[model samples]
Target: MTPQRRVTLADIAAACGLSKATVSMVLRDNPQVHPNTRARVRAELDRQGYVYHRGAASLRRAGAVNAVALVVNDLANPFFAEFAAGVDAALAEAGHVLLLGSTGESVERQHAVLASLVEHDPAALILSPAEHSSAARLRRVLGARLPVLLFNRRLDGDGPGDWDYLALDNRAGARLATEHLLARGHRAIAFFGGHRDSSSCSERREGYRDALAAAGITPDPAWLIECAPTRQEAARQTPALFVRDPAPTAAVCYNDAVALGLMAGLAACGRRAGADFAVVGFDDIAESAFATPALTTIATEPRARGLQAARLVLARLRGELPASPHTTIAPVALQVRASTAAAPDSPLQSSVQARGPAA
Candidate 1:
């Protein structure tokens, strides 16, 4: 027996007693088509099991697909997960679909994913680039035609070539976290989690250093602990804080995941957070509020940042934004909670008390 023929626009037109152009208009949601005519066309198309060929349509239209691509370093991390959800929500509102990819922080994987996404002919791409990604390498993989937005991470170069950037105020956020600890009398504070080479991590570390310097306190080199920005890795590395003489009385962690893990690690080491040891984290993820002795963190508001990134891409696609590439540095706020407090009998607190009631 011969295979059945595929359904086409003409078939639906014939069944609906409407012209093929009318049926086509209905399929494209053209406002000129009458509502009743649209209903008939849609019913017949569904009954015939017709599927719209988006890829083929994009090719026919010279590479205009009704979807945007989002690539992030790690989707499993709550920060990225929330950011992706925000992007998805905004895209859905704009009647566009999202094609997502996770690189697991591998540049090779990012190249592979970008290559695949480009074949789909997305309208634009929003990327949180993997560690060590360079503009030259990404440009080679993405080519010049596609408009791109860089989120959170910056490429290792003078500037990100012709791509719009949305950067979290990493240095400011870290400074805020560190300052909060200092205000609470934590003199020996460690900076924990994330590799030193990462742009975001480095900026945060600089901020940490700035706050310490302002207070005339210099952190020991060993206090700057490096670990993958994940809970498990942070937990595994937490014990290192106590290895040296004059260990940190408090810590400013990379992100919420690391902070939460450190809290667990503290428990395992018979030290309790917010009491015996103070901890402050960056990125106020959802779990931060619910963690035992809620986390004190710098809130980047990942979901809102995601929405802003999506809006930026959408605006660029519509030609609403200027052709000149620009960078938007999102501001962060410190969310104080139980996780951070005055160091137990700290000399800093004693000195402050000695100064006594601001004269």
Candidate 2:
């Protein structure tokens, strides 16, 4: 049995009375192609049943690619979902498809995913690395040719020195959240969720510490809660914050998931967020607003950051970004909502009031 040959761009161009380059431009959705010509080419394409296999096409055309690889640490988180959507939008706008992967915050899984994607010969890779991902290890898995963008989480130690970096202002965002909690008359504040080793988590924790130090308050070790940066883990670890005699009156959560989870945990413990306790979250994921108390959070605009990441990688591939590893740290802003309020009447709040806000 003879199989039908796949339709080629040349074949489409010949039938449409246009050059292959013009037909290719039309296929790419390039805006410069005249609308009439684009319509003509598209009609011919439909008639011929032309299926654009971009990956296979890349193999045949040297130094040509129209696909990007993206690996995020945890797809379960809504933040990554929104970020991926942004990446998709930017890639589609540039006529590229995204090859997505998740690592579940496991370094071993990340290694496997990157190795598999490399086989596809994608033009670039944008990664929100799992915790403990190291540049030396990544370099071993992914050789130097592939343009890389490290998003959100930084690779451990020295990072990919030559890769593009697009990250949220983690330290600043956490600082803003902590400062807001302080302004609400809460002194015994806890930095909640997330392990302290990951760079993003550490930076946020640092910001929390900075705000506390600035207020002349020495945070108890028990008050700095550590969890898996997930709702389940955050809820499980909630009791750790209260083991001390005077427990923190408020908390700066690692992200929206943790904050929402903490709120739930607080409910289980017979406490209310806006009335009896205060909570501030980071990475204002969509669900933050509708949480029981309408969470107050730091808005990192994950989708916009995703767009910025995709565009940056595309620029690197096109020689638009500087050769010396382009780095972009997007800023964050606080969104105040119902989750936070004046600290509940407690001995800790009174002691703090008596001393006044840390000078």
* Top-scoring candidate (lDDT): 1
lDDT score, residue 15, model 1? Answer: 88
Off by over 4 Å in 2: 1-5, 8-46, 53-56, 346-359
Model 1 lDDT tens row, 182-290 = 8777789999999888889999999999999999998899899999998998889988999998799899998899999999999989988877788889999999989
Per-candidate TM-scores read: 0.90, 0.86
Write the residue-wise lDDT of candidate 2 on 65-184 in tens digits.
778999997777899999999999999999888999999988999999999999888889999998898889999899978888989877778735778889899999999989888877
Candidate 1 lDDT (Cα, 0 to 1): 0.88
Colliding residue pairs in candidate 1: none
Candidate 1: minimum summed lDDT over ten consecutive residues — where? Answer: 350-359
RMSD of 2: 4.7
Which is the leading candidate under TM-score? 1
TM-score of 1: 0.90
